[model samples]
Target: MAEKFLQAERYEAHRPHVRAVAYRMLGSLTEADDALQEAWLRASTTDIAEVRNIGGWLTTIVSRVCLNLLRARQARREDDIDGVPQTQGAATVVDPAAEAEMADEVGVALLVVMETLGPAERLTFVLHDLFAVSFDDIAVMLEKTPAAARQLASRARRRVRGTPPPTGHVRQSRKREVVDAFLAATRAGDFEALVALLHPDVVLTADPAVIPSPEPVVILGAHTVAKGAMAAIERAAATGVALLDGECGLLMAQGRGLRLILRFAVQEESGLITEVEVLAERETLAGVEVTAL
Candidate 1:
């Protein structure tokens, strides 16, 4: 009874820190909670005498559980499509006091950007860069060599730091502008305007199956994307529906219910938009807020 009490006490004390770590790793509050619950269940079944450092052991268990979840996610992504490549960038250094000010604005935006990173790279970078966990410790959690963990952290650092040119606050504002313009163009059927906004090397990719493309089409360059957009708009119009606010708003038919709400991402360089990523996944769009037009 005494030993059980002691173990429970230790687990309670360390739960908050473990939760923080899991939340940062998974990027979803719900997932973190679930992971913590599973970790605790595993810990409860283990022999108390065999474990030396209870805190460390609990943390490792939590991390391993999160890692397994991440692996499953990666496998699903691979089977669905050729997996998205991991990012290589430097970590953003935000001042403690300034973090609050940036919470809703920059903080949320940064979290969204972090979604682009692969699970392992994100875990390594968050542990090493954000939470100050040693690479050796992270390597243990990941079951990888320290040298490999460090390499993943370095790549993540570069990707985070390498803003699409311009950098800092100015870059963020410009990105918002590009998104707004793209949304406007798609709604108004302004192909020329949309083409003008895109960089010559612009690349547009929509989620497979969700967007209902005849095949996975990768449109290169502003002109090409503009043509594709026009075709898409025409098809949508034929169905007696128009996209609200270009691509950022919900899709509603003349007499039918709301079909889907599309979320867009615009990556820019040197003030020119280079990449337009449209996510039409119903599951992904669940939490997104779209304005009614």
Candidate 2:
């Protein structure tokens, strides 16, 4: 009984850091809390009598729990594509306002980029780069060699950092400007500005993964496209201008969950958007190259 009490006390002492690690790994506060509780459960049930490093042991336990959660999340996303319903885990009600604030506090861009990483890559990066966990420890957790773990972290770091902004290209810079203006208008809910940025015959195409239709949906004309864009004004705050496949595009996300990538085709003379492609299919999204502008 005394040993159990001592273990519980020690868990409490390390709760904050462990919870932070879980948050970085899972990118969701509700899920992070769940991971913490599960970690504590595992820790309490196990005997640690001869354990030399209690803190490291606790971190490993929490990280493993988080890694399992990340893997399960990936599986559920794949299942979603097959029309399989997924039930949520035991999670507390999340307030959008609070979540947004926390995202800001944690660097929203970083979290958004991290969402694109694979489960093991994300875990390795967060544990090593973010928390200073040694690669040796990460390797054991990931069942890989220390060198392999380092390689995973290296790849993740590159994706998170992204490529530098384009230079010496007037056309590319202009397209970026237009995208920036479009995003600004969307966030401000300015109908006229949105219409001005689009050509009269502008075409907006979306994959079925975006709208649940049997086939891809297409909308034409500036007014029609502007109205559709306005309808998604609420998403503006969560969207950002990014370079997709070396073209100006928008990456829309909600609380670290990427939803759609909007690729724009702009006419050089008119400087107006001619076509907009909305991609949400998992395969398409995975293949997209997102560079922070």
Candidate 3:
């Protein structure tokens, strides 16, 4: 009975960590939840006496499960007519105030970029680069030679070289400043200032489930995006939604629950905002924490 209780405690302790790992690997909450359930089942069946570090063991199991699922998904995509794997495009924009609200969690831009990698590459890169897990341990879990795992990480690194490193602690602080400016412009209905911060090649996409447009509504120039922002601001003003700071901030609904929350990313060429992305879905907001603004 004591042993069983101990095992239960260990499981509970590692549950949140496991969910985070699974979410990062799979990029889908439903899939991560399934992987977590399987990890728990495997943990329960194993003999607790042999497990020295229950947390590590559980994490390993969950990672492996998520890796396998990613591999299978890749394989299925390969068999499709186009023979190209599906990739997540740029995220939808939300109210800057709403985004300011969720600043404590993962950045939306980082999450979107993560979807560009293969499952193996993402898992290896995240483990080795983000978590500082040793290459050897990652190799063992991935069932690959250490050298191969190293190569996988190298390729993933090359893919992201154009973008700023996502793991930097300083990036978060800089992003908050950009988001604040964005919300203020939106609230004040300043289209020209809003356009000044956007990149020339900015793209805007509405939720497909909501908009059902076949193609992503790509807005090419900063001026064009600013015009659209002006229209959106007018619409939002009609609804009494105000931008906080310079970005979309708070989102309150009558009875339907809150709508889109804003999150921002600023790509710096020489310490200026280049690319800005906003994410509003609740599922996307799960890992994010909103500060009181």
**Candidate 1: clashing pairs of residues:** 88-158, 88-159, 89-157, 89-158, 89-159, 89-160, 90-157, 90-158, 90-161, 187-246
Residue 220's lDDT in candidate 3: 55
Best by TM-score: 2
lDDT of 2 by residue, 222-253 (tens): 99998877654355655677667777778766
The TM-scores of all predictions, comma-separated, are 0.50, 0.67, 0.56
Residue runs of model 1 more than 4 Å from their true location after superposition? 49-53, 81-106, 164-293
lDDT of 3 by residue, 27-70 (tens): 55556678888888888888988888877788789989988888
lDDT rank order: 2, 1, 3
- For lDDT, the strongest prediction is 2
- RMSD to the true structure for each prediction, in A, is 13.6, 5.1, 11.3
Q: Kindly report which residue stretches of model 2 are placed more than 4 angstroms away from their true locations once superposed.
A: 1-20, 39-61, 71-85, 100-116, 131-146, 158-170, 199-201, 206-224, 254-258, 280-293
Give the true-structure RMSD of model 1.
13.6
Candidate 3 clash total? Answer: 24
Candidate 2: deviation at residue 260, Å?
2.5
- Candidate 3 vs. true structure, TM-score: 0.56
Location of the lowest summed lDDT over 10 successive residues in candidate 1 = 248-257
